[model samples]
Target: MKFIGRTVVLLLIVNILLVYMHYKQAGDVIAKDSGTPTYQQEIEVMNRSDALYIRHHFSGLSQGRHEIIWPEASADRSCYALDAISCGRLDASLTAFVDGDNEKQSISYKIPKENSESQAMLYHEPFVTLQGATVTSTLFHITDETRSGGMWVNGLEQVGSKQMDLIDYTFFQGSGGVQDLYWQQNSLPLVYEGEKLAVYGPAGHTEQFEAVDAALKTIGADHSAIVIDQTSIAVQSQRFIVSENADIDKASTLFLTSAMAARYSIPQQERLLVEVVASILGDKAIGAEQSRQAYDKLIVALTPEELALLKEVVNSKAGQEMNATILDDLIKEVTGFKTSYFKTAIQKDTADHLFLFEDTREVRVDGTSYADIGIVLKDGKSLYPAKSILSHLGYTVTANEQSLYIEKEGRKFRFPRKEPFYVYNERKFDVRTSPFEVLSDEVYFEESWFRRLFLLTIDKTAETIDIVNLSTVLEEVIE
Candidate 1:
């Protein structure tokens, strides 16, 4: 037994040593060429401030030529790119490098003291060294409101004995919800002329593409001759450029200019005015008949003073410059003429001694029109259809004989039939009015209940009730 125990102990010790040796060999291989770069890029975007700081580290380099490209690098007379090796004023693009020595190198750049518009910062490395290399590219984006920031990394490739091309990094920063949906649609692959081409912006605005296509079609431009995505719109053999962040009016004007330039030529000034006007009318200006109708509506809606202001602005230098802010102001002034579509309507009927009166009002939820869903008007109160609205907002709504339950993401609500109180999560709360059954499967509650429960904005007009979910609009709804 002692001999057996001694043999077991010796085997355990030998196995442990062998395992340690194997790990050591693997660690050595990892240390030599683990595909991870020796250096990294760090970026910090200060909260509630316009300050941006970026640091780049180049630790393990061979004695050879290497380069770093920063596409978003820009400098004024006061600001410049700085490093231990060299410092220079940056132009639209910055290309910095180290040569002949293998010492560790780094660079740091800071934006100017003044506040600037939010932008995208991109980093690229394209070079070869004696030792094999791994290239990493990063993009940092900051929103204009400074409310949010994001970073993305890409182009991780092991470069062995061959140079790398400049990595393409597409960065998109957009307000959430419908805007995000549009961006997603724009990013989809578009097929044109039996060929697939990727679109990247600083260019095409997807929303304006349909209108531009319609106008082009009216003017004898081939329907398939132009292709558009959120990034850039290609007109057969030509490419038109518009900023991804361009407003509807500006994007429409630029697209119209491009389309006209490709096919039917138009005077620049006249085209600008026409495009701005069409864009202001939105999709209503898609065809000639709709354009005439939109024009008539605009004329009828504008007051004499507003008309004079519009004319003055259109003839002024700002209008000639197609200034976005000024055009936005004009749009705000004319927005009353814009049409609103509703999905459902509530009909109220009242009976008197000798007469019957009936009234109907349209309803909209979150700017979406539902033709089949409706609200109920009872005893001078607006009663909302609980299940339809909640379900439409992506809630799971279930009902029993006694109570109705609603849940979405993590929020929960329960209302006992004919009760003036509701339970949210595990907590109960009182309400001024109770929920009641209008039909076998339909239950209705006062508008205040929905407003309080869902953080909705209820805008009641004579002809319509606009129920906008504040959480969805702000893109802050719980997951």
Candidate 2:
């Protein structure tokens, strides 16, 4: 009896070991089968190769025609290279190879002459664009797509303490012109100079205005808001605030946005806007000179009323005393400024015909006809009540705090509150307008829900919301 009991215990231990070994083996097999390099890894590898190719080809390709080819798939499975060899003529005509997934594509440019001066026209071809990198063509030529020339990036002989990624160099053969194009990874263009373009990025975290320093004028405003009395009786308060860390470009952008939104009809009104912006950031190191230049150009253009308004806001003791509240004040003084958030109204069309469902049933909900059922605002956006539409289509509709749930067959869709985006079949889409509003006890959604999700078309001519039921169509075809 003791021997038999020991044998049973041994068998149980062996079975447990076998089960453990089986799972380990299965896990190893799964890992081996699913070991493809991830998409992000592919992107990184491609970017590095682009850098390499650009470096190798930057100066000039071989003088004669040659075909360059790389494999469609990288050996390490890190990046996707192209499979086909690209052939192009190099002597009389210029050919450009555009990089793409799984294939090589080429575009040709006409070279007027064989001399180096002729090659300067290569810049006319749109240089290659990368996802996180920008390359600017300055003086030289582009033979390679990846690497910028190694020296003097963005005017610095060495990159120094500042950060820079790539610099491409090209020397014009006889013109003795040296062009330097500089770019940094994941940042704005450092130094980009092309034809009809001169743009300079911020030199440091802050900038000092050369004109402000030369003029030797000191202006300070303690507060952001200023109240000006053109007279003792007519009192207006203008508030414009600028943050300490805010640069001139940002100030200009904010000023542009407010001025544009103000919708000023007259050029003088816009000039007043510029003055307000200048007064707001005039003390700052940046934008002061730019503001002054703009003011000089616009000063001659202002009418007497606009000029007086500008003087009242900028040159007066009240204007000087006025501190941070300049933005609000200038916007208010603009000709057609509106304070409301939503400017456009919902738009609707006149209903020419009555509505019916596919089954020949007149569509009605809550004593409202189909024409009255959908609300079209002046913005050309429309919405229909979810409960009414879902019920007519035989869908089970329910609502929760976060979303309105609609289910038909085995498919479910969730439309969230106050979100212009919706989820269907586990996919999210921007339906142009959020179009979802909850009024009292009912939920409403845009007409896009029916057109996009249910694949139904709203026919204004037929005056019917044509429900394209695939099953019914199939059934009719069979009959």
Candidate 3:
């Protein structure tokens, strides 16, 4: 009997060992699979290569040539990379070798979508021809598609009875006389000569001003005056002067020049500028208005001279020529003036303002009242009846002895009755004000809690506490 019992115990031990080994083997398989790079990761690597190719080669490509060489193994992934890099502005056609001997294939991408349709119609062969024994010709042509009749080209000999638009004719005729003007217009010029600093570009091109300003500030050129001009708008300090033909279509030159000029600016200021630029660039996930507000606040702290320089650039002819959205971006890129925590910090500072109302205020949800209880104004902060307001807004509100639970659809929020933090998806976030109970039944929450959790807008007036549903506001906007 003792031998039988020992055998049973031995079998039980063996079974437990087998179960543990099975789980360990399964876990190892899962960890190995997870360690392997995904298709998305491979695609991202290809995309980076595609972006580098475009950045280095795009501008240097001859007119009418936009071909990119990609690895044959990932040639099929070019479309995804191009779309992402260009933000849907560009599309490509893959051309693979029939023999498949080469490791690389060529993918030809089309021009931006806005220009692609009219491109073929706009440019025709043999519009102008040049032949000479001793005469050398330099041609410059620019088309401002956003404006009506804003095209101009230099050194185009008109063919018989072709009848080109008057706006198409270049303002200056000869190469010798307008060479400096041509260079200034075609490129970004940060030229300083004899107490006069000249930056040539659109007034809306803030980057040009930023680079020139940083350079000047670094060199302590406080006595110098800046001359900024384009074709239609010109703003100059009393000491500086500008010519008539200094107009340009290129804003990209400012980016290249600014990168080089940043070396001359103060190192700490340059680092701050880089941080601001990164913040602005990364702010697409937030909103453009947030970035604009941050920029506006930053400029307010600039010195009078700096402000004047900014105003000149923003109100110039070249600035007026740019799209409003593009102008906003340029304004946000203004750097090297003052250091301030931009968007995120500014938002927090603004939100810290707590108001105390003297009069009794009624709660209005979407401009209408669904509950009889008014807002509780305590300690200079407005608190709303949480259960009543949230229930009307389609959220189920329940309370236990220690915590309150608010849920909508699949989303759940847990607020500890005594703690100054809320839990969402098991993640705790500290808040400025903690939720409290009234009369052992009603739960009151701060204005920020509603805004943060549900994106509701709270407008406080003398007589009413207006709680606006953002979706309803958007619908009204759409109408």
Candidate 4:
């Protein structure tokens, strides 16, 4: 499903993830298979010579231009590269294509009814989304992405507003309990910045987030309980990411996805939610009571709240009394089923656990410590969640997100954004290139290097470092 991990503090602790297992779906299920791409197909797909045409079958051509799209079906089996011929769904101006490009191509299709014998899955009546991979203008220019298995395409710069779809799926071990639940699909139908993941999983269909939200509401404290809190992002990178930051960006992606769930989406947008999250799901499998206990423990630790407060919230606010109606809607887009899904090492007393949100949109400065938070109410200010901030700092804070960075009085520490930042045993070394967060006028790091730097520089220069044990300092930082 669309995964959204964020920190949400209920009026009380009425929070927990709505994890569910899948039993047998109550309908004649549609089947699907992953398509393959060939070298020849690849050349055809990348053939930019043609105004690759694409138009949605369901919506038909808007009052705009249309064209035949490039195909990507042959690049790799079961991959996301759209076959140039099937590369449908191009973004439109709602006006005709200039230069006689408004040619007619058909892809008017939508999810089929359960009983409909006609093509019901995504592959069947596989509608084409014009401008499927076509990049557009945006503040955050997306260059490319790490697609399933391998690269989606070469020379592919990521961007916003690309035509996309969602897939709803459940991982089941025969008649047994659910093993995994995933709602794979593109979160943004189009975007201005950031890599949009193209997720088309087992259930080749988009689900109704609104319905899932409603179902979630029904499960509130009365049926179940859940409390969510704000999240602190931790970014760690192994190598310098000049063009992109993989590990770091992944954390930020989760953060943004969670934020999206916190906010509701419109009908058109809501279709992106996966099936499990779109509706009240599997109750016929697994140990509900046992699973519930595990879930409770997971959430309680996530909040790091006093046991008393945790008891109060889950017992009352989240105790099926609230219905978590808002969260239900949230799951439509930012869907997370289990409490563990939301739980992350948001921070630690070290920088090793930190993650980056953006590679270039933001910057980092040398510091001994810091905090990271969001503008909840926009008082033109926001409260820095202690955990969120300290985790970003290299301090010995309670939770990693709320961790701190401290060093010896006379020692100095240094951390950089690029790769090969440190050195190895003999040559220069490398460190997890996680960026720290700034909050409440402090830089927090969950990894050791950033923390050591912050700690050592407590009273000394924030820039220059002591030269006596350069190699030693680097070695200590490596581990």
Per residue, candidate 4 scores C-alpha lDDT tens digits across 1-479 of: 22221111110111112222011111101110111110011111111111112222222233344333323331212212234533233434322122333232223222222332211111221223233222111111111111211112111222222322331111111111111111112221211111111111123232322243354345331111111111211211110011111233233323322322332231222222211121222221112232233234333333333333433332222112222333232222232211112112111212122211111111122332222232121122221222333344333332234323333334322333343353222244355554444532445443334335433221224322221233445667898
TM-score of 1: 0.24
Instruction: Write down the TM-score for model 3.
Output: 0.24
Q: TM-score order of candidates, best first?
A: 1, 3, 2, 4
Total clashing residue pairs per candidate?
2, 31, 2, 121
Per-model TM-score on C-alpha atoms = 0.24, 0.22, 0.24, 0.19
Cα distance off (Å), candidate 3, residue 230: 99
lDDT, candidate 3, equals: 0.36
Best prediction by lDDT? 1
- Model 1, position 191: C-alpha lDDT score: 25
User: Candidate 1, clashing residue pairs?
Assistant: 204-231, 343-370
Deviating ranges (above 4 Å) for candidate 3? 1-359, 431-440
What TM-score does candidate 4 reach?
A: 0.19
Arrange candidates by lDDT, highest first: which order? 1, 3, 2, 4
lDDT of 3 by residue, 1-479 (tens): 54344333322222222222222233333433554211100000101212211111111111222233343222223333333333222233432222222221222322222232231111112111111111122222232323223222211221112125432222211111011111122333333322213333233323333444454334333222222333433321111223222221112112212331232232332322322332222221111334334444444444455555554443232202232233334444443311223322333433122221222456788877644654655566666778778777788988778888888875789988788888987788997667554532457766776687777988877667788878889999999
